[model samples]
Target chain A: MAEHTLVITPHKTPRSTNITKYFSLLLLTVLLIVVLFPLVVITLNSFKTEEEYFRNGPLSMPSTLSLDNVRAVWDRLDYTTKLKNSFMISLATALAGVTLSLLNAFALGIGRIKGRAFFLVFFVMAITLPHEMLAYPLYYMFKEVGLYDSRWSIVVIFAVLHSAFGTYLLASVFTAFPVELLEAAVIDGCNKLQLLVRIVIPINWPSLSVLFVFFFIWTWNEFFLPLIFLISNANQTVPLAVAMFQGQRGAAATFQSTAALLGTLPCLIFFIIFQRTLAKGIIAGSIK
Target chain B: MSYKRTRGYIGFLIPGVLAFLIIVIVPFAANIGISFTKWRGVGTPEWIGIDNYERAFDDTTFWASFQNNLQLVVAMTVIPTVLGLLLAVFLYDNITHHFGPRVASFFRAGFYIPQIMPMVVAAIVWRWIYQPDWGILNWMLNSVGLDQFSHNWLGQQDTALRAIMGMMIWFQLGYPLVIFMSALQRVDPQLYEAASIDGATWMQKVTRITVPLIRPEIYVVILTTAIHAMKTFAPVYSMTKGGPGKATVVASYFSYKNFFERPNVGYGATIATLLTGVIILLSVVFISVQTRQERLESQ
Candidate 1:
């Protein structure tokens, strides 16, 4: 990227440039606070009593960080079961969705089979097919099959829903693949599965990882599908629960922030840790 | 170049295609069929061809919701894009040269945290901030001697939709920021140096060079965010529940309400089918425009 720049900064800097630099820093600092302030509010308010929250008016540093609201919200919402269910459902969806896309991409992208273009268009069309159109029928369909109230049902639904994006992204990775790799694998008596398992997968792991992280986070945070598909309290994902509690309780419930913080905790932690990969993943997603 | 195609690829594709069929394609086709019928949430459907569609076309609620969707799209897409581009340009110029990569990235991440937060969580957070009695917005207004300007942000019909739109704009900032900043990084700096030599100021450079250079990224952000806004359901669903007299009803929420709230599955299917058509039309136009641009650029 630096190839574009002709180096000349060794000379004395202008006073105007120095002023602009400090001004930009100040602006960015304020903007950073604006972005972080809400989460900060949640974190601060979650520790305080309901009166303290109202009196503090969203700016009080928590008098002391207490586990009181955490324990309360945890018990009230059956947090343990819901978090476990969310992890299982989202993890399963991500695995199934990403794996499906990899094979689909291998077939349609690397193999260059006949009618691949048609399949490409077919999947692209699937991206725009909104869930509202299919939510009711799929609900009834699952009810008939006795899959209506299970987390696994959502796992299957999200897998298919998100694999469209996965296929779109992974296909790009496979399209630019060197033909020599495939030819060499075939000459070494490797079958198609071997070609994919050993060669294509290893080569495209970075793109696959990107797809996996995004699909996982997306599934974890999904609300509408969980609302439609999972009817029982035991099966609801975290977002569904937060939205339900906030709506039903009208933000008067002291633990609303507590629940919201708990619900967002996993993804927030993941973001703090793997944000670089997440950013790269999003960038990769857009380019394709 | 034998061009002899084996049928092996079909085996690899079976799992994905079958899942797509069961989950997406089957129900999708069933939705189209269902939209033409009169079915409640129950036993039998009476085939009433185009009746639901006709009802939707005449429905005031649907048009009102669609109008709200367009307004939200402008808020979510247009204003956000301009603001995000300005933020991106400022950080790209200032931090990259003056501070460092770490500072630039830290700023980017701060802007992105809300986007990464689940919309449900964000809704709850903003709901507290919009609390009519003790909410921060009203509190600040009172403090600033602008108490007359402050009302229940999410309560009144006049301000409910705009309040939700404001939150949408606030939370949807990071998408365009990342896209444009990333695109701008690729612009050859020699052009900037040459422009500067020709007596161009920073504003001129942005309008003349940076904007033109990152046109594709701008289009992508606009199209994607516009579609997102048009189809948005969560903010309204969580914060206002399309309440205060349906002031905040959006297309997605309208479709959702018909199916879930009213149990009008048939009509909901019709509305969803219509929304899908609009999205597809928009997407097709976007793709064609992008391709045309690409062709021109290559030329």
Candidate 2:
């Protein structure tokens, strides 16, 4: 944006600024390498057999690309089940979280209910509260309610928990909604529910979709609470499955990298698909 | 506008509030109550008010965990914000001025790749990279003829925390960088032109123009990252598990161990309650400071 307005610079740029510019480029290149090298190494090693890994050295390219290590690791971890579990939990949390946020924000932002400030502060504090603080008690409560070790336990906790931020974001977005539109709808006999479904939500679809993507990805990336809640192997999420392989002490090096690669692939796919939305959401999310 | 119509909106809040109460409010309150009683995983509690808090106050490990958390704040919050700011300014100011915007954005996306992966996945990758004998770090050290420095990066008390901090800084850098870069778009380019016309240096422009313009975003990033630091669990859990003789134990993992491993529910709750207090207190300070800065700016 600033580039167009930079009209006054000499046609031949000054030597000092040129030096600094290249230096910045060099620095960014180094940082990029540092940031990406581990991921590249993991991807590279995941294709190597254990024998290939031991014989050719960690840095060497494999003799031939192979899927044997990938298959072995996937089978050992039962990754298909983990993927299904993670997808179901994340999807449920996103849908429920956005719905809850819409309702709460409607009341707080548009409805201007009594004690809205208290509720706003309550939700803000909830967003800041650490997961560990809620983990133990939720664990005890879920066990008492016979929901422990159930995937739904994770879905419920995260939906409510993440909606705290969702409500906070959506409420701010809602407060800016034009009152004239609502008044016109009300005059046409639109009740509150109809107003939300027919008018407000459609108009604010961009922000709501951004919120949905965030809820989905955040729940998908979660590790701590799921580790505590989903105790059974049948119910474990993807990250938990990968984390259970933490020590992998006696296993071959190829197996660990393969686990890392598999664990990251789903989120990497989401990132590629939702990059722009995620960027916009961060901007909306940071504003007061 | 009528009282009855205003009451209608409260109906929208019932489901949200009900779920919030059950999932967050009730569990939170129960955790606080559990802090005051003596209990294990399976048994009824005995009232033991102040005993758990006292134990935390005396427990050296508890205090060390918090100290380690402060280190994480530096890694996750301070270093990231500082570096992210410089990097953002570089891409926004220098790169865009010299190269095309596409190049700058390509760099931004590359830096942000790490933030998109699950932390557990990142932790696994880094753990492998830091593996003592066969890991890349050791291999690179040997290749460079510096093999003596190639010890177990994660197995030593002296290096484990620092090693994890390095990983965190790498993991955390992209968030603030992206936020600040976007925030920079809101900055008027004319300000930079005017500063240049006045013969101001690049450092001067950054200090006087860029930093002041994006202070709010900086505050938001700091607060969020600091909270993440305080809740440092996944990385520590996967990499070190608070190992090398409690060297990398953090508040969250400490409380977690107490809860499950030790089965000391009361003491775990005490640690959690204290950690929550610290976080809330930090948040209050960030918010108040930010609001005051905004007021000052408006004035």
lDDT of each residue in A1-288, candidate 1, tens digit only: 464343444333566788878887997898789877877877887887776766666677778778888888888788888889888998899999999999899888887778888988888788766688788889889999999888988898989989998897788778899887787778778888888889988888888887888889999988887888887888887788777774224335358778878877887888988787788887886664
Each model's lDDT comes to 0.83, 0.89
User: How do the residues B148-184 of candidate 1 rate in per-residue lDDT, one tens digit apiece?
Assistant: 9888889899999888887887788988898888988
Candidate 2 lDDT, tens digit per residue, B1-299?
Answer: 42233558999999999999998898899899999989997878888999999999999999999999999999999999999998898899889888978989999999988898888778888898899978889988988999889989999999999999988988889999999999999999899999999999888998899999998888999999999999999999999999888899999999999999999999999999999999999988888988898998899
lDDT tens string, model 2, A1-288? 578557545544677778887888898899799788888889999998777888787878888899988888898889999999999999999999999999999999988899999999999889989888888889988998999999999888899998999999988888888888888888888889998999989999998899999999999999999888888899998999998874355555889999999988998899899999999987887774
What is the CAPRI rating of model 2's predicted complex? Answer: medium
Model 2 chain A poorest 10 in a row by lDDT: A4-13
Q: Which residue pairs show backbone clashes in model 1?
A: none
